[model samples]
Target: MIKKRVLCFSAILSIMVLSKLQSRPQGISIENPYKQIMLEHAARLKEEAKSPRNNSKAYFSSLTFAEASVPTEDVKVKSKLSQYLAKFSFKKVRSHEMHNRADKYLPKIAKILKSYGIPEDFKYIPIVESGLDPRVSSHKGAGGYWQFMPTTARLYGLKVNGNVDERKDFIKSTHAAARYLKSLYEEFGDWTLVAAAYNVGGGSLKSSIRNQKKDDYYKLRLNGETASYVYKIISVKEVIENPRMYGYKI
Candidate 1:
């Protein structure tokens, strides 16, 4: 009777070990079937969650621009600019003709901006403003990449006459732009605001600054065009330095 009882106990223990081994994978040695099953279930659930959801209601339907959420302060303007940069690609104007033109103009602009302690990035202002085409004149009488109106040009010491519009002279106009930029920086103490004020006048920018109670360009309420102006300059700077990164082949 004692031998039979011992035999039964040994057989039951062997069955329990076999059952545990069967519940595990071929290469694994999991002792708990419940834990192994739970881990497999979790993995499958993760894959399901990663699968694309086709329901349109799950995401935003309307088109939204980055600036929509930005506050009306100069700093916010810079921050929003960093966000806006991801959406658009840049184009490199590397045509032989354009490069030739840029060669003639970029040096002088760089020299003047350097003299003023402005960033080397300022050299591209003409690329956006005038495409290095001195003969190019805006309908509003703003000319050159530094794009100065007759009144502003004169204020910056660039002569605008019928025979000789100094606005078309790269060297003279850039000098004027440097002087004007320096003055704007002096008044606002911020490069972002100075860049914006270049598009609009300093007086208008200062009024906006005071009314907004913050120096942040992004946080301040501004006209749509002017709001984008400073960011456009930053975008231009980024693209010019590494056009390929912005997806411009040139």
Candidate 2:
């Protein structure tokens, strides 16, 4: 749960200066505004070379200047997004309700997944899917913790009826989700892509993989939403397991 680090503008500029100083040892430290002074000094040195007799006391005096001051590179600057997210966390509010509702449903979800020998991370599917709200429905009619559409939910053993839509049932939907995730993982052999497929369907995901010529999730070129989706899930998992790492109290 390491916080993401970003270097400051000045720090990056200093690095560029240090890189340019590699060929000239006796001149500018280049880490200071004295860079202009050093440039003038180098120009005078060249002038002295052009006319040897012009290399007088004035030229020698300028070359004997002290080293440029080194500004502290250790200064830590906070990221604006990190600061903003810390001041206001929607996850904190959403997660409170989830934790309460999860107590009544997570046990059932875990039991089904465990009985099928699914990975424990599968428990997070509900959080990413519907925030564990049974009545949740996507614009595409994907419903429940499984977020299965009308056809796919039934294909995976969830019953949808006028009186009782099993997609809204925690136990049945978790099982269906587990089976679907497992099947996608088997097909792609990568959990990250499997999660992406869960969002955008397996057919399009496979097409992306073929078009990119990369089986690895990190290497594939995906749309912005799909690209960040896996990392978002991982970020949520990291935050939940150890909230303090991301400046969360819970």
Candidate 3:
């Protein structure tokens, strides 16, 4: 009697599980939330892939900033960029807000950057730095539109004292940022490396280059953030410049 009861309970449990499985949608499971999210994302992407405006070639080609190009052709770089592209693959309400704020300044910033002899694309630095937010301050003592550290601000001829912080002054700080980025470009002779220096500090990048005997930004054994710094900027540039290509409505 005990054996019969146990067998019957096992049979009933198996039947319920089989029924649940049969009732579940084809090739979809409720077990893993992460997988479910990815599947949903893939479905969205499949829909977007049908759009004729989706241009992967043009998007990949724009990865080159100044004379230096991201090695998006490399398997690792391609994979990494795909990861960022996925992360950036979102509706652009936030980006539209930033872009609306950016419009008033980007033309001026572009002119300033051009006059300063830096690539106009470099103007995106401040976008990545503070999203055109003149009031943003980092925990690392960086502040203002360009996100200058107090010392770096002063070094670039911006006043950052208690009485008045010129780092918060849009025009002054943009000029300072242009000067600083130019100086870094002069030091590195590569805009990509200059960008890395801008993010991770010239000293650290210099040391990495010296020790590694490899000036290539992609080759250096950098801190994780620094390693992917230029890639982040490139990713932002890709999305911002071609929102439609990335499936962003804004």
Top candidate when judged by lDDT against the true structure: 3
**Tens-digit lDDT track of model 3 for 1-250:** 9999999999999999999978876554455776888999999999877753355555565577665667766777877777766555446456766656667888888898888999877877887788888888888889999999999999999998889999889889989999999999889988888988999999989999999999888778899888877777777776767667666562
Better of 1 and 3 by lDDT: 3
Q: CA lDDT, every prediction?
A: 0.67, 0.63, 0.80
Model 1 bad stretches (over 4 Å): 1-104
Cα lDDT, model 3, residue 133: 86
- Give residue 29's lDDT in candidate 3 (0 to 100): 47
lDDT of 1 by residue, 119-204 (tens): 66667667767767877788887886578999999998988888778887777888899998888878987776777787778898
RMSD versus native structure for model 1: 12.3
Task: Give model 2's TM-score versus the native structure.
Answer: 0.59
**Model 3: residues >4 Å from true position, as ranges?**
1-62
Supply candidate 3's per-residue lDDT for 153: 92
Worst 10 residues of 2 by lDDT: 63-72
Candidate achieving higher TM-score, 1 or 3: 3
TM-score, structure 3 vs. true: 0.75
- Across 50-73, the per-residue lDDT of candidate 2 in tens digits comes to 642234333222221012111112
